[model samples]
Target: MRFLLIEDNVQLASAIVERLSLDGHVVDLAPCLADARAHCATAEYDLILLDIMLPDGDGRTFLADHRGRENATPVIVLTARSEVSDRVGVLDLGADDYIVKPFDFSEFEARCRAVLRRKGGASGNRISRGDLKFDTLAGTLQVAGEQIQLRNRELRLFEIFINAPGQIFSKSKLVDRLFSYDEDVSENAIEVYVGRLRKHLSASAANIVTVRGLGYKLEV
Candidate 1:
């Protein structure tokens, strides 16, 4: 998963980035709310790890602006503020979860995973289509209990398909989904990822079919 870490504490922010990177996440760190908002303008992040006391702006205001204008990107607030009201305030401001400073890294990671799982779906954090079950958070594709691991792009393509079910997703939209502002994506990149995911699915490829010149759609 690709994540954005909006934190001003250089030491703690580096530590968190290292930990998350070791756990198989591609992380981008921003020291202030301005940099974070700039990244948000074009980059697509799976989740955002935010700090309340930013150098340039308040995290609450940033969260409000984002929720009001953009896609509902899951956010977990990391702050030194430990008061009951502080926690309530952040949560009420649209944060997916809140964690106080001097926290256990293990628990923080667990909370991040839980928040992502809940936002994605149920059924044991899996997206099912007939005999296939894809564990999105774990990035595992299981066919009748046989597990298969997917590459980053392949998993991302599958994620889009599973999220919409039967709806048609245009190639342009898929390209936008697979790429961040930091990356240069061609129009055909979507087709490339879809082709790779189709090969990975084998017989299950029937579930994802082209919609002629329009794009692609997933059918149960």
Candidate 2:
């Protein structure tokens, strides 16, 4: 899943980004309300991890604006404020969940997984296109009733493609989703994985096709 994290603390932001990335989520971070709002306006995200306090404005104000636009993207408030009124305000303003600061990372991850599951994303962890199916948990692919083994990178690439079938994703976006934020893997690496997956897919390769001037899309 893709997540937008809004927090003014640079260190905490970095840590959260790293941890979420390690859990196979693509995270985009913002340090202020203005930047967060701009990102939310332009990009598609599965969830938003918002901090109530920001340098430019209140997270509640941004939440109100997002709500006024009728945006239904789920939000989880991660903030230092744990007061009852603050919790009520955020939840009533349309946040999906709330996590107070100095919280356990394990709990945070669990809540994230739960929220995503509620969004109907967890069931499709195994991606299917035509006669091909990739079980993300087992890291195994089955084609024409034959099991096909894939390398680590190939599995990651196929996982991303299969999850959002028919959605055109740029090479950069794929790279960001496949690798951790700290990794320096090149854009061309995606092509390499695509080539390998195509070889394994053979005639079924048509399901994963290039979009002119765009990127790649997995046709269901």
Best by lDDT: 1
Q: How many residue pairs clash in each candidate?
A: 0, 0
Cα-lDDT of candidate 1: 0.80
Candidate 2 residue-wise lDDT, 113-168, digit = tens: 66765664656446566788777656689876779877667776776677677899
CA lDDT of 12 in candidate 2? 88
Candidate with the greatest TM-score versus the true structure:
1
Ten consecutive residues with minimal summed lDDT in candidate 2? Answer: 116-125
What Cα-based lDDT does every candidate model obtain?
A: 0.80, 0.79
lDDT of 2: 0.79
**RMSD versus native structure for model 2:** 4.0
